[model samples]
Target chain A: MQHFLRKTVAVFESLGDRSLDSFERLGRSTLFLVRVFKSIPFVFLRPWLLIQQLYSVGVLTIVIVLVAGTFVGMVLGLQGYNILVRFNSESSLGTMVGLTLVRELGPVVTALLFAGRAGSALTAELGLMKTTEQFSALEMMAVDPFKRVIAPRFLAGFLSMPMLAAIFSAVGIYGGYYVGVYLLGVDDGAYWAQMQKSVDFHEDFMNGVWKTVVFGFVATWIALFEGYDSVPTSEGIGRATTQSVVNASLAVLGLNFILTALMLETS
Target chain B: MTRQILEIWVGVFVAAGIAALFMLAMKVSNLSTVSTGDTYEITARFDNIGGLSIRSPVKASGVLVGRVSNIKYDKDYSVAVVTMSIQNRFDSFSIDSRASIYTAGLLGEQYIELVPGIEDNYLEDGSDVVMADSALILENLIGRFISEIISK
Candidate 1:
């Protein structure tokens, strides 16, 4: 028993040492990222990063947004209508659609879709670059890898998230309208009119937009951090990609709670 | 490259369509009469304007015709003063147009509802709607009812 205890202690100490080393490396890369952000004015020197981010966030993810938004809206409308039908208060569909889409579904669904698609891709690309020593090569040439690779992606993810959230909100509301009005046979005028009346500028739309910004930062930062720290091996690259998706998704959810709490407190 | 270009065009179209739909829906709803030269202003005072927001609809007989334009606190009256823009078609609103803050449903939004009265004097733009009602918040009403029942 004593021998087992000793072995366990030794294992724990080695694990702790490894974790400390990883954190130290993370600290350095984060500082490097900060420096790259400071030099964003020089982004005119490399427009490809912006284009790449735009393409990745906007153009590539349209189908996912469309499908997800439509399905989610349909489900919400169906479920909400089921519950509301008990009271014979079907006209509250507008408030229901507006509230659900703006407060919860808009930001959360978009972030999840982004994580599955662009977030994974970003991690793998960065991980491969790290594993191939391409990052080191760029450094050797006095080219800042953070500026060339990390910053552009970070900016792209950040900018793309809000735009995606907007699209998600718009599409989701329309989806709800279609399902509620046409399919479910609810009054079209009341469904839309109620939404217009119920949805306030400050409470609904602004809160949704605010949450997306946080989601963007969390997704980009976690994905980039994971990729930047990948070990120089195929296995390491694979591990980093997996970690990126998991970490980015978790971070998106975690930050969403924090933002919701903060918004509630302030409001 | 061709695929990318096509994809970009599709995205733009999708985005534009969504935006246009929202605008069209808002236009068709006609909640506010700001566009049709049918807007008239009226003021209401409330003791508390809980969750009352600018641009919230003003409804009469469940038909929307205007919106809350501004809100302010009256120091002398110790009340919240809400200014609303009603349609000029509702121009024959009497001096007794009663404004009440009511919820759409349980756990839903709040809007100012106007119950038009049959008094002689007509309410003009910038005139005060004499009778005003505040929201009977659910918690407060329930609490009062429960207390009364318990006491009884």
Candidate 2:
């Protein structure tokens, strides 16, 4: 009885410590996010740095986005075609695929991929710079590392995410077409006709654009915050990279659910 | 040299995204489907307009002819008034044509389907389609089934 009581007390104590640690981290992250936003003017001042970061973060990730997008779209086409066929409404496969991709899967998938690829890379790069005392060196030279190093990368990530997501969606629609029209023998005209009749520009497509913009902001903010706050060690760099991806993904999904509910309720 | 290339690539990327968005608007969204060509409006009255709304397609023999332009409740007749815009090309529908609300599939959207009669004269603009059939309400059918079972 004494041992059990002691174990229970220890568990509660650890839980309390974890909650307090999380709250502190949250406060620090919010401050870091604000500081990053404040440094946006610096990004514009040195447009070269923003361009360099955009190339590294956005351009480098294109191949993966294209490949993942094509596969996702093909799978959706196959599955949607089969299900719609069951109801003798296979002609609406285009509408089903288009709506599903634009409304939900497109933004969500792009955000997750960006988190895993660009977010982790950002965390590692910053964490390594911190571990090597490079930030301190910059401070010695009277350079604000936040303005010079972090701002451009954060802005690039924010800008690139929406564009990458749009490209993914476009490629995905073509993949769906390849499967549904070329392979499954669904009527080409009916597919496109149904899509036009059903999908609304403001309701579906622009809503997706809105979602990606929000996701880009949240994911990049998390990535930058994790890296800036990383403990100055090799292990800390590794941990920060992993945590950056995981946290960004969770934030994207949670924010998606909330945004979806709000968008639906209002519209 | 690399800076110029990267700048060009970024411009191309932005342009591609915009192009895709424009294609989506043209191909999938209803934005481009609004008929700006010549069309005439007509009204129909029904007792129940179940699952019907503006922008629903107006079809004749499985061919889309126009769209429902507006819907209103008539206080004097205690009926639903539905206005449809028919294209000029499909102006051959007769004055005695019957308009019935129908579902595309078992659980699909409702549309107004017109069946032409043997009348010599064609329907004019601002004319009423007097033989309007109301929509089939599924709930009412299920309730009737349950009541019949209880009585039996």
Candidate 3:
């Protein structure tokens, strides 16, 4: 009976502790976010720092976005064509591909890719700097690490996502067009005309823009916060890197559903 | 890599992204535009629009010439009023040009087809298309055909 009572109390205690731990992390991250925002202006003052980080974060990520976008679009075209052919509505291939990319897949997929590629890299880099005491080294010279090291990377990651999403969507549209019109013998003029007739700028495209911006913000925040708060050990750095990717992906998918729901209501 | 090389790469990346956005605005959604600044407005009334909505294409001789800008029910007249904003270059349409609601294909989008009528003057902004033919309802057509056959 005493053993059973101890097990019950331990389970309750474990659950309570984990929840409290997450709450505390949330509060700390909010403070970290505020500090990052405060240092943003300082980051802009030195454009070179931001540019260099942009090279690492944004430029390097483009190739993947483009290649993935093309394949995704081609797949969509093939599937849409096959399904639409059954209904004798193959002319609508353009509308289906264009709307699907602009409304959902473009933003969501690019974000997931960004989380895997840039988010993990950011976390690992910051975690290593912490492990090597680079943060303290900067502080020893009376230089604020947040302004120099953290904020630029955070800004770069935040800025990169939307641009990447646009590139992805555009490339995907081309891929779909190629597959639908060239490979499948669908009429090219009818494809474009049908797409132009259906997809609305205000309703489909702008909503995607907002989704990417929000995703960018969440992805960078999770990445930077995980890195800055990491335990200063090699093993801890690895753990933090994993946590960054996982957290960012979950945050993105969850936020996507909410944003999509809200956008649907507005449109 | 060197900072200069990195800067160049970033510039190229940014340029590509901007280009992609331009393609999306121009070729994807077409930026929700009727494609010109100088436009003229003309309203037409139909008994039943039959799935016609705002932004539906307005065509003449199978060529897209304008877009439907607004649709409202005229309670007093018990009809649907459609406003079209046509590009100014096509201002040569006669004042008596009539519009018919047309379905493009089987289970396809509906649009407004303007049929030109010989007249002395051209249509200007804010003028009405005097004769607006309503859309054909498939169910009503089938019902009428069945009733006629049974009566006969």
Predicted structure 3: clash tally? 0
All candidates: DockQ: 0.14, 0.50, 0.64
- Model 3 segments beyond 4 Å from truth? A1-24, A188-202, B31-33, B36-40, B75-77, B92-95, B118-128
| Highest-scoring model, TM-score | 3
Stronger candidate by TM-score (1 vs 3): 3
What DockQ does candidate 3 score?
Answer: 0.64
**Arranged by lDDT, best first:** 3, 2, 1
lDDT of 3 by residue, A95-145 (tens): 999999998999999999999999999999999999999999999999999
What TM-score does each of the candidates earn? 0.73, 0.81, 0.85
Candidate of highest DockQ: 3
TM-score of model number 2:
0.81
Q: Write the per-residue lDDT of candidate 2 for residues A36-133, one digit (tens) a residue.
A: 88989988889989988888788878788989999999999999999999989999998998898888888999999999999999999999999999
- Comparing 1 and 3 on DockQ, the stronger one: 3
The Cα error of candidate 3 at residue A226, in Å, is: 2.1
For candidate 2, write residues B1-152 as lDDT tens digits: 57799988777766876776777777767778665688899899999999998878899998888889899999999999999999988999899889999987889999999898988888878989989999999998899999999999
